[model samples]
Target chain A: MKHIKVFKTTMIASVVMSGLSVSSASQAANWLMLQGTEPAAAAGRAKVWGFIQAQYQKDQSDAGPTPSGEGYIPPKLIGPNLNSQQQFNVNRARLGVRGIGMPLDSRVNYFLLAEFGNNGITAPGGGDAHLTDASITINTDATRIRAGLFKIPGPEETLQAIHVFDYINFSEVSNQLMLERFPQSVDTFQGATDTPDASMGQYSRALGAVRDVGVQLFDSFQSADWDHSYAVMLGNGNGLNFGDNDDNLDTYLYWSSEMQFGGKGPRAEGLKLFAWNHSGKRTNAYNKTQEQDRKRSGVGVKYLQKPFRATFEYMQGDGMIFQGQHRPTMVFNDEEADGYYVDFGYYIPNTNWELDLRIDSYTRGENFIHPVNATLNSAASDESTFDKTTIGAQYHINKKTRINMEYSDRSFESDTATVNAQLEGVGARMAVQLTHIF
Target chain B: MKKFLMIMACLLSFSIQASPDSKPFAEKRIVLQISDPDPFKQTLVLNVANNLINHYGQDKVDIEIVAFGPGLRLLFRENANVDRIDGLTNSGVQFSACENTIKGMTKQLGHAPQLNPSAVHVSAGVVRIIDLVGEGYQLIKP
Candidate 1:
């Protein structure tokens, strides 16, 4: 309570000081409607934009050293701790600047952005600022070429800004397949019937930084009623701000089109269809450092109408992260996985209130491979699947401030003898968040 | 905890000192962009203009509205929002209509099209915006 009061006081004081400054400035300037506080600058001049997201998450999963006399321990996925724990965090603190160069030809524009927030949402480590975007665009009226660190052409949901996401947490499929980080604790499974090699755990690495260092060429084909666009990129497979970690480069391609159903401008409404391909390579087996193939493809649809919106996406991939689990001494084998999600949202006719729902699921099609010398039998035909459903509501206090509340139910099931010992369970979580844009 | 507090103090100081709002100048200049073909969006642009004029007063702020492509229709003589446009113009807001769009529309209609009398024809809407921004005019695409 005391902390909350302190935070509120500080925030109010800042806004008051800012208001005084804006009201007293004597210069002739254009005022930004949404970003009203920005200092006036010319069209070709660079300007800064950013937002902050702070949140609290509570997990209701009954996960501990072991589950109610179960013979083995299940891998932790929902919370950062080895056991379910609640947390308060600054999820994303981002800052960015973009504009056409003031002196250079108007055709040339540049953007650079960075995040000083939590590194791993469900884990430890990462209290440093990291670059998220650094791109230069040379564009004509309809076509453009962009090079540097940017988002890979993939799922539209992955490409959307986190501040705009309707749900507190992303769909299960996006979390497991796209972010790709696996649980790291071997301590919880120490007494299990089949012990994993604790020293070989891959917990040090996190997957699914959506953006990569890349170059993309994109253009649009437009008519009075529709807009069609396409983009292709080649990038270093490694996530944000880093050079390629492997010898092979990654490739991404996307195509999309929107057909207007409503009149033009803010009232213009449309339905869109999009498809993308992601192909890359990843290193497997920590000791041997063997190179392996990674491929993914997806298709989705989106509908944008005033006060209502909906999106659906499906994706499949085959990679070295055996059966979607990264563990110490895990075998390096080809595994295929697929997932999909449906999201729907609506806003109250004349209020700041909004309602939303989402369903997400993922299936791993390969066997939960076991260590070669394990004491328990490796059930080769067993498979695992995950599902999650979320119901949420949001209220826009104004254009720049918002509050969100969400409830989610998640379930995991597997048929393998090794995992059935402790893996099959259901968990529920509730979260609330506050977002401010500047 | 101490380190966190120190960081927050530094950030707040920087936020205040680095505010882009403190440039030494004689006047405030603003540009409004209407690139969407929707009349509803154009009205929103006008609303923003009115709000700014109300807050800063018409005499203190320099305002311009730039339109092109499908957005050019916002300045058509028969536009649904012509009265709103004229009202804003009366308060010193300038409107720039893109000649490139006018030419395209004229070719499509097989005759030269007419724009609202309040609009000043420009070679290109985007170029006008670029030039204005270079002169330190902040853009507000409401």
Candidate 2:
């Protein structure tokens, strides 16, 4: 930490000295960060930023082996921890950074970014960190073109900011989306049991991966009464930071359009439609077994009427294979899964407090392919569903940070095994995260 | 060419209406304006424009948006549709940049925002609002 501070000061001094002799034009022209900020940079140029979040989660129920991954068969696909003493544990402390460059002439040109869950979301060493998003933009009026590791939406899920969701983990449907973002979130990946294969547990961020990275072009259309914007991207099939394996590259599309509905006020009134899509890829396991091409898709809607904002989205991946007695890549017939979520929040017009609620539901495709529990069995119909609900509030300390608290209620139902695995469980996600936008 | 010619005709006719001699208030309607330093809000404003363009036709209605403060960005000079500014501006899309905010805000951001001289430079956010309202621009903060 001390070394970084010294390094920052030195770099600034060199630039400041160089800038000292130059005219205000050059000084103003040479963008540097607002010197006092942590994400060091120049003025006139966009700034860079990053953050760290610490969180904890507990499953109120004891997990048994099942199609999804772990836990005893609950009456539903998602439910509370059944036995506190044997409950599973989830904890996270993560950090990331953002880099915006100094502006040049005629343009307030700069980069926008974020990263956490280790350089890679699924990288080894188990630190929940990742290079979330990094993109550059050339601005002009209400229109601009952005390129770099950017966001592509198919679902309401945050493609570049996955960890911000109120729930500690993503829904099942979100996990299956294009390139199987964060496979661990669906089930143990190991069809074998509710308990993870201790050897590889260190590799995956129990929360999983984010699928946004690629070059995108964006622009806006505006009028006195309303405004609209759109973005399109081409990226790695395996979400951001997943790196290239043999997996093929894919294309993504995102469009957010809206209008001022019945408005005659001091505030703008409107409703919007935001949708996104990605090319899905099959793992080596599924490819060897099935020749079918699978894909991921998502749609979301947002409406803002003064102090109220409501958003709902559904996203899904066509084919995936979790870990199993076979191999981690083995594909089974009809093995595809997806999920949906609806979230709404209200904040007093001029206050920092917001009331929020979200409902998420999903199914593990393979939950129908096999069963857990060495003895008693359940039917496939009984094991495929999983879902959860969360109602919460957030207090914004300021523009760059906020603290959130929520109550989570969940349940799951399985057929083939006595106890369903990961998808069905009741739990609480207690977390605190810091965020900043540059 | 026909569509282009038609759009051109519509643009020319609309400009004539903003003239004080030809007030557009003969119809029961209103105009709105947005000016914010926010990127999200700027994007939203554009969408609103699209909605108005589609529903009201660029020619039939009187619409104008005045931007200032850090808001000068919405119309970055090099934006791909740099020409869109002219298309909107010529058709009565009044753009205003805050001279005071521009002086200090640009210093903070590192450089001055790319702006066309054609954009009106107001001395302050408050004054800009008052001036536009005085000109009968409906006030809307989206």
Candidate 3:
């Protein structure tokens, strides 16, 4: 009788274990929510992670002549000293630590990352290391609050996880318009006589790298089959510096809705629609007493599914615009500009190969104020349109490593025939990079 | 008394054979092991399991995913793949969470970690794999 009772008890235990069930809750996929966040249940004191990108890039454009017999300088890769046609570089090497306040309180988490690469983040200042992200987030039932130096909510290209970026270089629009470059000194040089013996020199202090010191409130939620996210941030207009340049603070707003397709992680499969705007005031270094309005806004759509991917983005800028350098002259002033890009990709079935193509165009200086003969003059610049088409291929060596190869066909345009002819020398570029995440 | 003892032995053996939570007529059994922390690997393991189910009818095959070490992150309640886990659960796939890892994490975390409802606690991930293998299941480390 005792043995029979034991048998019945064992059967009951088995039945109870097999019948276990729990209530289900809905979940959403938001990179912002997933990237730096630790799971509430397994929140650790410290977790370290990072990635490295090594690359070689070459500019194929050749110097040519303008109609006036003046030499036309072809574009060069932007780097230290800024004149290399081809070179090998450790483009990005970053390490970061992230964790929640475990035994104390899981609601608070922190993320800190540093850059040790030969790129804009460090090279501009000749520094060996640059702190890119240092932020702390507090989670609540309603929303999450993050504070410190971090990437502002804006373009998908800038907001997404950089380690998984599909391309080695950013689009022309994102590069020139979004990536803030700070000038070391004001440009006092006018035309010929007043031109400083030395050029303003490559932005000597810092590169924004699409980051700002700010405080943001953000969250993500699921409704039906879609995951929606939103963020509002207030930041110092200055790039990497912790302090604001002017009394005016930058305001950023972003929203995204993604239709989840049953995948996870940074490269999840989804169709996302997003829009964002950033507005701020910059204290002009050239005219210290004067503050210029800076505004940027964008809208885009991205889709990722098995064997196919597509992205399209359109951006606009008003007021302060970076005009880059012309000989020893540095230009930054109020201007109007716009740009757009379309990218498509295909993954070969049963293979590790993926092919991609992208077309991008940008028109700058719609209302450019030219510095001529030691005086500021209003002019409609004819040489302002830039376009490029990029063909790329990626080979996934393993889950954490991949090789990327790309060739870009570049071109320039102007209303003046001679200016257009002079820009014809602008040519193609090729780059190859290997990325590993650990 | 000898006859009664024999009958008890037979019944115990039969109960042990029927105790597995798998479909009665499953033609194939697979146990997938995930021991890496990489999110890509975690997602790939699920993809492999889905592909297997697509190839073999869900009723014809039984699948169990065993996670240990850092791979336990995949079974966290707030994991990014919560929807995928729910879908797979409804499809009859099972997820086994290693209790050993949970205890280690608890020590480091100062509190016990919460797991997805779909994940069933197992004494150890490797031992679970071994038990499944002993039951004629194929082992795949994806």
Strongest candidate by lDDT = 3
Model 1: chain B TM-score vs. truth? 0.79
* lDDT (tens digit, per residue) of candidate 1 on A140-192: 54456788887776786776567767877878677666764423333111333
For every prediction, compared with the true complex, DockQ reads: 0.03, 0.02, 0.13
DockQ of 2: 0.02
Cα lDDT of model 2 by residue, A121-167, tens digit: 42333444445445655544344455555445455455424434544
**lDDT at residue B64 of model 2 (Cα atoms):** 52
TM-score, B chain alone, candidates in order: 0.79, 0.62, 0.85
Error of 2 at A414 (Å): 2.2
Residue A366, candidate 1: how far off, in angstroms? Answer: 4.6
Task: Encode model 3's per-residue lDDT on A143-204: one tens digit a residue.
Answer: 88999998888888878888888888888898778987776453333221111122223566
Tell me each candidate's i-RMS in Å.
16.9, 21.5, 8.2
RMSD of 3: 8.6
Score candidate 3 by lDDT.
0.75
Q: For each candidate in turn, give its C-alpha RMSD to the true structure in angstroms.
A: 18.7, 15.3, 8.6
Candidate that would win on DockQ: 3
Regions of model 2 farther than 4 Å from truth? A1-43, A64-102, A105-130, A137-147, A159-172, A175-208, A241-243, A260-269, A283-292, A321-334, A348-351, A367-383, A418-438, B1-115, B118-142
Error of 3 at A306 (Å): 2.3
Question: How many residue pairs clash in model 2?
Answer: 93
Best by TM-score: 3
